[model samples]
Target: MITEKCVRDSFAEQAGYCKILGSSFMSDLLTGLGKQLDKSTETGRRVLQWSGDPAHKADALALRLAGALHALARSGQDQALAKFYHNPELSSDAEFIPAVLSAIAANDDELYQWLEFAPQTNEVARASIIYSGLSVIAKRFGLPLSLYEMGCSGGLNLQCAQFGYQFKGVEFGDNASILQLSPDWSGELPPDANVEILSRQGCDLNPLSVMDADDAAKLVAYLWPDQPLRIARVEAAIAIAKNDPPKLEKADAAAWVEDRFQADGAKGNVRVLYDTIAWNYFPDPVKDRIDQHMHEVGSAANADNPIAWLTFEFDEEDKGPFLKLRTWPGGGQAEILASADPHVNKIHWLQEN
Candidate 1:
């Protein structure tokens, strides 16, 4: 059974993560809520009396509430609540928690409804790091890719090949594209390789469509208010996706991979399976199934139909996220290519071109 103290501790812990990710606004906001959230309001009651595991790795309870507050703010339903998002004076030590408490009371029903769903950021800039990995694969194999993404959310990154990228000094994709992801770089730059994505498909339990106005708006709202760049890039990506949306299906991660492997596609293209900060969301059983199934299918991967597993995920030991890759014919060999914060904004290249 989850204790009330445990849930409240998760709020503070998540706030620390927000701070580390360069969102002091989110950090302070979450801190204020964690310190003061009580059973006076329906939302507070539901949050405190939650039955499920509320850790970031489990239910992500803190992020759910944070996303909920952001959604309510974007709706323009509460003026006082919106001020706490970015206003320095309003978010000061004395006034911040009061503003948070007031908002929870005023928007009790909406916030409570939001807790039923998980948060989906669909961060667009992280694609730059994924593109760097793609660049390495392209240069190494000199082949087109059949990309499959797990926990795809809006499938915005599925259109990664369409977005502009700059890894260190090396550039890829259309320079004039509305969405440009140029993360801070170091070490040898990724080689300027011709990366072609022959096919793209992704799976998510609760997939959002960029073409859907409501979904699009919801995605934008989840972005931290202090980071307008994320908001702008998402808007651009959403606009681009509307022109030619990638294939996204609602399915379990394990089931989707099994189905995709069973339904063979065009030969000779490198089959890449990738995800960003999404692995922790999979339940232990689901994780095992996906891993076991991948190993089974990966055993058959050959030079002509190679398979690559790419990931951008947190490493508690490293105190930050790392970009890692494993490709069969040598599936057992794993390579860490780069390191970056959760958003992949300021990154250090780890591999030589």
Candidate 2:
């Protein structure tokens, strides 16, 4: 059912997403990259028949090339292209991009290996929106929070407490922390609440270990070349994670949620389940199991102990992704909170916090 146009269309949409997210450099590069894929080169053919789900078609190919280019640039193996990524002046010269891409695609072995892996964006900038939501939940519940994240690659966000946060001019977390998040915060600030992370754990189908050099490189490589700030944040987060890595397990999300909800939380812990942009990948049955489990466990929740689900994901009919929160003991009805750009560039708060 997959046609070449299907592949081309995915890239075109992804390119637009990059542009809207403030990465004009990535937008241009991806536009050029799509044309290169249409040329039926070895790389193009490989991408044309991508074996993964349709939702990931474009991202899978883009990440493969980006990761390979990043590896080369980091090793100083391709000084010309390395400078292109580091210096905006050189990369903006559109005339030089085709040659650079061609040279990158010439390495068949590397590209092939990259194609074998899925795109693990593991973007940490999104932590800004997540932090905002979590702050709201903790304040609403007034209980020590126990966090569990699904689709947590490298589990960097699981270490969010270690990173500093700045929302609408209010700041918190380790001020000395290198990984600070001060996004273009807008709207009236949510009620300031004390956050206590009693425990944190995460699960990914194929989890990357921050402790492993090769795994860490893949995580860093997936970052867009033009966004130096994002690249820097990933590097800083990796360094922070090395000291104390998250308790990440390689497991299926539905099964993990079932097990987590079935177990009893300590006396006063508020069990929190959350993820950013990871829900769409779950199959229908998996989604059903998780939903049913949440409802069943939620019915048993009491005021002294609680359960909350926080999600930042795409809503097909909405202008952008919606931030929805549902809490038990008060009845787990979904409350639409905010709509944010795909990369969390800007957020529009919809409810009074």
Candidate 3:
């Protein structure tokens, strides 16, 4: 039996020395691990410890095999990869880490092969925060929003604006916004405010069409394992899409925003906003183009017909994550209101100096 203490120590060991795996790869590994909890025994615990050792040349390979084990456990399938995992000679092999990293980087059939072992769950917590944040922004802007999300995988976050939110101490359920915003405020909740979502649309370079169940599952599998709420949120979003799908377009973010900004309906009683956690993936030129387009649109905008750019992303200074608010007509500096969690959950409002 693998005691909880053993598991914790194992995870700590893995977490401390696995920086060489790169953040994105580590995220994927953690997510895979989350799904494999049931099948993770004492042997698996020892394997995780072995995988975390910085001095071990085969750590990366062990991690890869562990991820494979998790994927298998999630899929409700037999552990066919157990032989590869249990090989003693493979543990000390110098080439193991590099090989595993190469496989993940390639995103080849091996990645999918490992993914087949995991079960999907709801991971809506981050989306809930986004909905909450949007609600606050809409109130501040004095307009209903027609949200346009970039890099929306399966359009799950889009539905947060359409669904309901039920937190521990607070209860507010109407039309959900991009993030669900209702915490049990013991004192007083923000004034009985509401933002009409004129429309909800999203674009993804590699959009996961929810019409296909397998694609939907893959999207869920891609989510972080620590975020179980996201899994539920995704499942709910999938259900909503099946009933009445949101309008999703397949296009590049810069091109999509530029074209949409130039379109007629882009100027309406709605605020057009793009929120993404995808800055690292985009090139500098693409980022520049997006900024230019938003600036152009903002210059032409008015209080009567306002346009806003609201973003929750990471920057160099703050390092973690922050929310930026920019508006039209009064085109000034973007205000960093809160220092937020990368996962979009805990937000510490920054005090102005």
Candidate 4:
């Protein structure tokens, strides 16, 4: 059951997320839209009794609405609203709110259908942090990596090794590649060792296909209107993906990890299971099962065929995202390599300068 207050709060929370991530335009837009939705007789009458896991309904609704708006804009149904997004000067102009509202009212049916699924932000820049983590692990183990990712939307990060990276005066990967991540780096540089990815695979409940035009558009829809650079990055990744889409399997996160661990590690390879900003979405039971399976596999790891769990997730005590690495055979403790923003706009390495 979705209450008016519940919907408002969800929008408010997403507003906060956008504001913190440096999108004043989206933050204000969402706040105004939420208030309008709370007071709209049309919305109340048209939007059906909300259906989904109660925990995610609010965010789901907000994302669905955003998708609807993007869909309308891309379809050129609302030139005014579309212009507001395409031009920077038009942002923060409250005059556009009425147009946005009208767009929503016209497409309430499609928006409601979108609410059935959770938002798949599909942030690929996060793979920059993952690349750093992998580089460190490779330096330690000296073996090629077999990568597995949980909640990999289009599995763009699976191809992180193919993209160029620039961090604190250091550069790696294909310098000629169109996509590159150069986050504001603070503290000491990460290991300079080259990490070889022998394979890349991931699991998503409903994976987006980078090769599909509609699927790629949905990813763009999820981006905040305020960030042009991010929009370009997604486009760059999509272009690269068109040539060779990353291997993504549709499956439950915990089930995939358990199945992967059922067999011994391949000879002379280091199996690394990694996820970024995706850990919190998993239910307790699923997380518990994945954790148990990883420990079991880590315990049996040998020097020649080792295992590592690399994560860029929130540390409860620190109340922030940290880049962490835990390995087997010799790695029993998780190491905090760096602390980062929810997006890879900024990263602070924990290593000594």
Give all TM-scores, in the order shown. Answer: 0.84, 0.85, 0.64, 0.88
Clashes of each: 0, 0, 27, 0
lDDT at 8 for candidate 3? 46
Runs with alpha carbons beyond 4 Å of true place in candidate 2:
1-21, 31-60, 92-107, 316-319
Clashing pairs in 2: none
Best by TM-score: 4
lDDT of each: 0.83, 0.77, 0.56, 0.79
Best by lDDT: 1
Clashes of 3: 27
Task: Give the Cα error of residue 262 in candidate 3, in Å.
Answer: 2.0
Sorted by TM-score (best first), the order is 4, 2, 1, 3
The Cα RMSD of model 4 versus the native structure comes to 2.9
RMSD of 3: 10.3
Estimate the overall C-alpha local distance difference test score of candidate 2: 0.77
Ten-residue stretch with the least lDDT total in model 4: 47-56
Q: List the pairs of residues colliding in candidate 1.
A: none
Candidate 4 yields a Cα-based lDDT of 0.79
